[model samples]
Target: MKQTNLEMTHNHLKSIVMAIAMIICIQNANAQFANSFGKQKSGKQHPVRVYFMAYDMQYPGIAIGPEYDFLYATHQKIQCNKGTRYTDKHLYFVPQFGIVKTDVQSVAAFVNIELDFKTIYQSGFIVDLFASAGYAQIFENQPADLGASSFENSLFASHGAFFPQFGIGTGYDFRREFNTPIQVNFRVLSASVDMKEFIKPGLNLGITYNL
Candidate 1:
């Protein structure tokens, strides 16, 4: 049977519509498959982790503050039986502000550029090397006979000094199991308080919570 021109045009349009629908379905399926593959490759993607609260015991004194990972990057290397191992070997800028006490009580604010190396494996061990420069407002203790309160002395005798510090630390991350990411690190620090004088060696025990 010979088809009319109108019928032939209608059939061609129908075929075109069906082809478009099939393409749409294939694209949707491909997107779903890609999403599923990503989930299987990496359990949960957390691009940025925050250290909401951090405690640092700086030798003769202690400094308590918060630091977060910013400008972060990571690389996946070493394919294992389970999957690939992801490592963070990048620069992290951490800013901290808190009270510090040494020979004199002070308020410290610092920004650190850190090179951190860690593996996102079951073990979760981390190593960090950082350098920081900041200012501290030191308050010299008043004499007993001054008869001024501690707050009054701190308010009146405060002076600012710039310092540079370098430290190396190692710790373990407890995130895979607990869901609460906590890192406890022991650090060896060298700080130059006098700016031009010799650097003073110190120890630091730090705890940080990563969210």
Candidate 2:
């Protein structure tokens, strides 16, 4: 009986030891995996993400046949991101579709880039300036519903041309830059063909994710 009791105690202690060893091994493996992933992230650029922007602005200067121009319009855009946080620069090709109240078909595209003016590693709010150039084509498609259901018409602005774009924005991180995945930002963009004729100006209030 004494021998059996001793054997049981020894076995229990050995089992506890083995269990502790296994746990340690698992923890080590997890740490290594996380470290490797971090390295991979650092080496690559723009991990490839999809972003969407929903914006609303007043659509001014629309000719409604018998000399009527109005305001107040809403627009939407969906974009693919080729943006890198480390570089503090991003490029997006956005396809935008909008309606000018009741008679105009508003379609345009833009490619913009955000550049960080300050160091990305710095804490607090970082104000950045951005510039982008693209084409804005206004088209008039035959009518069915929703602003005449336009495809691409000559009455619209040139569908393809180089335009000048300029904007200013600020970026805020909740925690530190490297540790956070979600960021919030606000920016205003104006695309212009000449110095005076503006294609469009939009304000974007959106979120960004870092993978």
Candidate 3:
């Protein structure tokens, strides 16, 4: 059998990438909300929106430890659309990070992109789909049981030669207008790293504010 170079250790690079992902997802949800909500508020050169979409994760084999999250968690986005008087149909860039706060403090990083299309003005909602692909670096404390050994590269990457990760998700964004900045976004996203590794599904709650 070939020796697997892959080891289970904390990945700092993945942490940063995940943070960027969190931010982009949150912003994508918020922008759709703000654009379709109420009046576009006067005197504002740009409009920003915020939203919260419940979050969850799955990583069974690595370590089935206790799952904890910050009760007050959210993602943010900044929109600059130069279309509707330099208003709607704008472009955005988002990056995010998350901390698993409890007895143990663990962190992750992410970054992604967003685009808007189509608007429905009937049930106080915005109909647009978003797909974001990024990487996440995580850390594991040395317990010796789960095989945590010290090595040069504790972090694994998707953009590298070994394996790659591509996550895709979309759902309905509900909000009245662009100023109120409150929305309920539903997303079912999946990502796979290795052949034996399972595809992880994530649901994130995003919150944004116009800058």
Candidate 4:
């Protein structure tokens, strides 16, 4: 019975991940299709950005983490009044190391992703949508809860279980030259444990610097 429950949890998580991925793909495809009919230009660019973000989660608590993001052009460039812009596809990899400050103090690590909208060396207003999937490792100081029940133990084990996260936000770019550009954004963050069986949402204020 326990094994059956675990398998069901894994299956459900897989479905949620697949659905989110498909939505992201469809959005990108539509953007590409629209660009295909517009004026074309020659010039390719790749940009890398790093960020320091602070988040408040409804489940475990609050934490701060670092993120890395990069983008590659989609082979076709479209014209903009400023000049020309390319449909740059972005991929983000972020590892969050944080300390939960709730009644249950714990340390956790979460891996996250965010899709950014921008072009090389061009910046003004910006927006990004993000998602994350990972496990949280929790610890308690009191020894009384050591030999808890199987269900409780499994739920809050030293090595925790799966969790899924999603977020969206809008911000602005400094557009500075000969200096590092900065982005400030406000985001609505969310996550779930035991698949979508239990879910929570929160908020995040972040700052990103382009390299």
C-alpha root-mean-square deviation, each candidate: 25.1, 27.6, 12.5, 9.8
Model 1 lDDT per residue over 79-118, tens place: 7898866565544444444444545444433222233433
Q: How far is candidate 2 from the true structure (C-alpha RMSD, Å)?
A: 27.6
lDDT of 4 by residue, 8-117 (tens): 45654565465455546544543553354311222222123333333345444443343333233243477889787644334444444344432344434433333433
Q: State the C-alpha lDDT per candidate.
A: 0.51, 0.38, 0.34, 0.47
lDDT of 3 by residue, 94-173 (tens): 22223321113222332333332323333344343444344444443323325544333233321211112223333333
Arranged by TM-score, best first? 1, 4, 2, 3
User: Against the true structure, candidate 1 has what lDDT?
Assistant: 0.51
Clash number by candidate, in order: 0, 3, 41, 0
Model 3 CA deviation exceeding 4 Å by range? 1-93, 97-107, 114-122, 144-179, 192-198
Q: What digit string (tens of lDDT, one per residue) describes model 2 on residues 1-211?
A: 3334345446545544554454465445435534543233223322222223332354332110000001111122334374322323222322222222212444333322222232232353546465644332333344443553233222322233344556676767544545666565666666443445555565545455554
**TM-scores of all candidate predictions against the true structure:** 0.57, 0.43, 0.41, 0.49
Candidate 2 lDDT at 43 equals 33
C-alpha RMSD between model 4 and the true structure = 9.8
lDDT agreement of model 2 with the native:
0.38
Q: How many residue pairs of model 2 clash at the backbone?
A: 3
